[model samples]
Target: MNRREFLKKTAVSAAATSLLAWPNEVWAGGTVNLTILHTNDMHSRIDPFPNDGRTNGGLGGMARRATLINQIRQQEKNVLLLDSGDIFQGTPYFNFFGGELEYKLMTQMRYDATTFGNHDFDNGLAGLQRQLPNAGFSFLSANYDFSNTILKNQFQPYQVFEKEGIKIGVFGLGIELAGLVDKKNYGATVYLDPGQRAADMVKQLREKENCNLVICLSHLGYKYENAKIDDRKLAQQVPGIDLILGGHTHTFMEAPEKINRTNGHETLINQVGWAGINLGRMDFTFSKKSKQKINVAAAVLPIGKTVISS
Candidate 1:
């Protein structure tokens, strides 16, 4: 289907149910289910937007997000919370705390992993390093080479998580920072070719590691008219990537775009808007015997008063 049609179909599907329902047939035959909850470009929104009658007024807040995540964790057995990037900057909270509070709160909410956005370098490498201790999760970025800076050996190219006999391999990709971010802020950090890095990660994660699912947390936006290698391009160039949770464009996609890869496999790319206004969720049911994905469901849930009070 075309992008517009795909989006329309999925948006309608999501509107019908807050959480997509998994068909019973897909759950039969010893299938394992996993729920992935994700956010991107949160930009240090500690509290909900002021009730100023604007479009996004009273929409997002870290507290509301935490409560929603906790509720999902209680319902799902295998849950992974991930962020695509830009965990820092935007609001006064980031300006005052320099991302320390953001890291701490994400730690409390038990974020599994995150990638780096260009704005994440606003405080420079040293500042980011100082706040690293507050985060309980790993920073995964396969494309950015930090060996020459203080961030050397600080981030992982990818991470593997196993739950209920299912192995999940997750890696990260970042946007090129030269033009987007100041050179002084990202000094000595070399940006690698994201397509090549992703190919390498897929080989290791799928062939070497034998992961049942492969996910890429990408900060490469969704798509670009120019040749900037956005998430859509990455999906087309790389094979074996099952899902891509993306950011950097703050594009509010109601549903994920399913791209058919060259190798006959498919990839799902989803990115919620910025400022923690929405949470992107994807549910997958896999066959335990064949180690293949059987079914999938998704939703872009808005963070509003329906959730517990912040």
Candidate 2:
């Protein structure tokens, strides 16, 4: 799982015939291909940008994103759609609907899971509580202790999904909400250390749950010049996370960054830009005989523009 080995495993070129026949021959054989589609920091841009002269003019919209996701699902058999949080605020849609439409639309998109970002507390805890039922997916928050608040039992720390006999474990990690959020808004939620919580969650998911792949839905920013617990720092600190889908910094990573883990394994960290402009896709091929994932491919599909895969 070193950098070289990681590259070799996922080094299959996009032009390879094996990749072309992935959708058909994957499940029939002992290999299983799991496609993970993700988004982050949507910020309630339900409609596309106005026809003005801005740079992002008409570049993003829910309809286009939905169409792209649907097309991908049609080709890929086992797919998991996920979000990395900040689904609220920014646009006037949230100011008017209080995140109801956002949740409903995501539910329609069949998002498997999402984490909590600081802006998720914009309408305060009560507003989030009201919109919780509208979402079709679960909210995973491992570092946020909502036990003493009204959000008790409302969110899970981790979830396991079985796709084509491969057990995939996913957990959530949020940024520290103290300085970023108002006390009146967040209420009695306790924030735990993401690094420690992640270590514990990874141990449970890898050992007790026996998951073939472990993913972390992180609302932490990508990285900081200063000392901050960003996604890169988290990957270096935690051992078991195979992938980290991050938000909060609105980083438009052209591709996933492979970080060499302390245990000699590698962790993939990816984040699409904000405003529903991009969809992140990662494909991992698992070998049944070895009980280990062998291949990894990623594609960053533009929402309303041409598609690009790497």
Candidate 3:
């Protein structure tokens, strides 16, 4: 069976149902730290897995995820929650509701933004578009040209946000979904060359928009052995993209990979494992003392088989 099929057969568990200490200094302190929380290849597994003898038996569920997100947002002065994609198709939740539950839960969790994955088109363009309005966060896909379709103006090429004196630019890049998805499902959504589009968008975000941190929310997976384009290639070829949050490969990276781009700019790539069993967190610390990016502490936190609330 294909990877998606394997996950579909084994990953489904439950529906959406229902963390931590803040340093006192955070509410009234200097050295503002930005916490970036992310997920990918969620695949609509809305509940923590039951005791199934698997390594991650009891982890992941939208309700547990929301509890964690709310806890962090309440403490951090600046927090950005994002997802890379594959937000549809896995459990009967998606099969029955047609992605409504996933989008609604994501909306409740306040996802800042997300891209597209091939599986997102399982219900076809009309089905996906029908549920679009329910999403609180904007959908961005720089390389997917939706012109001549209903999604043209509804989606953005990139989004810029200024948080705590920091400028962040986020955009999306989709994998080539032709061979991966049914032609009838994706319809006339023209897929552009990701490398070319990445270069162009990075230039615009860094030079024109003056965004200090440029991030690419990618559903392009990570490195592949062959010539197939992936996130690693995009990072090496595109300059000025500070980070690439990736999906589509279900790559559970130990930590974010630091790579030097064509212009010698540093880019960090990270992806949590599939099924929401892990939550990827990257802490960006900008030193006002030196006026530079001082450090990045990255971790993949496990939700691990049980629901915990703070």
Candidate 4:
């Protein structure tokens, strides 16, 4: 079969084999379930849109998102909340406080990890560096090299989380910053090839770190017509990446896309709309019997008035 045909067949088979068929040994070894909640391109939207007749009016406030997240945490034993960057810029909040309030509020919301988007450098490296202390979570990025910059020691390439005996490895990937960002803003931050870097990170995570699952937080857009590397291409280029949470283009996907990769492996890619308009969720069930066996369920939650008061 050609590459395209093989990819299609592999995608279908992988999804069905993992989701439908379960080995008998799986039941004996017990199962671990993890719920991953994520947001992308939040753009410093701290408050809901004005109640005016705009499309997203009265939706997407930090308080409302916090309330929904709290409710989910209360129900799920093992949960991870992550962001896909562009955390800065958009509203008056960022304009006045220079991303300080954005990080503080995300800290309050208990974000586990976040990546940096192009707009994140809008206030310059010094601007973002100043607000790093306000964040309770880690900033992860494998592709952006900050060795000679103020952010050199600030962000991590990858993070490992062990929840209920399941080891999850998550790393970050950013877009090419040269043309997208101002030279003054992203000074000395080298942008590596995401597909190449992701391959290396996943290899380490799976082989050396012994992580049961691997996730990629990517600022690469969903897809492009000109063959620029995006999440879909990244998935195919790298192996062992279980899921990719993406941002940058603000493509709203109703469900996660199952992308077939080399060697029969598949990657699930999901992205929510921008401006904190929606929350993306993916649930994974892993069985001890077959380490590669997984069942995934995905959903998108529209941001609106929550049970918690504003």
Q: Compared with the true structure, what per-residue lDDT tens digits does model 3 show for residues 1-310?
A: 3222322332333211101234444434355467788999999899887758887777887788887677667656788998999999889999899999899999999999999999999999899999997899988899998896767777888999877777889999999988999999988899999999998898899889988788999999898999999989888877788889999999988778888755657888999889998877676766443324555666566665323333
By lDDT, the best candidate is 1
TM-score of model number 2: 0.89
Error of 3 at 153 (Å): 1.4
* lDDT of the candidates, in the order given: 0.87, 0.86, 0.81, 0.84
| Residue 300 Cα positional deviation in candidate 1, in Å, after optimal superposition | 1.0
Give each prediction's root-mean-square deviation over alpha carbons: 5.2, 5.9, 8.7, 7.1
The TM-scores, one per candidate, come to: 0.91, 0.89, 0.87, 0.91
Q: Write the per-residue lDDT of candidate 2 for residues 1-310, one digit (tens) a residue.
A: 2223322433322211122233434444587778899999999999988869988887889988898787667767899999999999988899999999999999999999999999999999999999998999999999999999999999889999998789999999999999999999999999999999999999999999999999999999999988879999999988879999999999988788888865678888999889998887787888765557767877666666744232
lDDT tens readout by residue for model 4, 1-310: 3222322432321122136466677768777768899999999899988989998898888888888888777756789999999999999999999999999889998999999999999999999888888999999999999999988878789999998778999999999998889999999989898988999999999999999989999999999989899999888888889899999999988778888855878888989889998877676777855554457766677778323222
Question: In candidate 1, what residue range of length 10 has the lowest lDDT sum?
Answer: 11-20
Q: Which ranges of candidate 2 are over 4 A from the true structure?
A: 1-29, 307-310
Model 3 clash count equals 3
RMSD of candidate 3 to the truth, in angstroms, is 8.7
Residues 1-310 of candidate 1 have per-residue lDDT tens digits of 3222332443433521123345565456687778889999999998999889988998989988898888777767899999999999999888899999999999999999999999999999999998999999989999999999999999999999998889999999999999899999999999999999999999999999999899999999998999889999999989989999999999999788889865678888899999999988787777776667777777777787443221
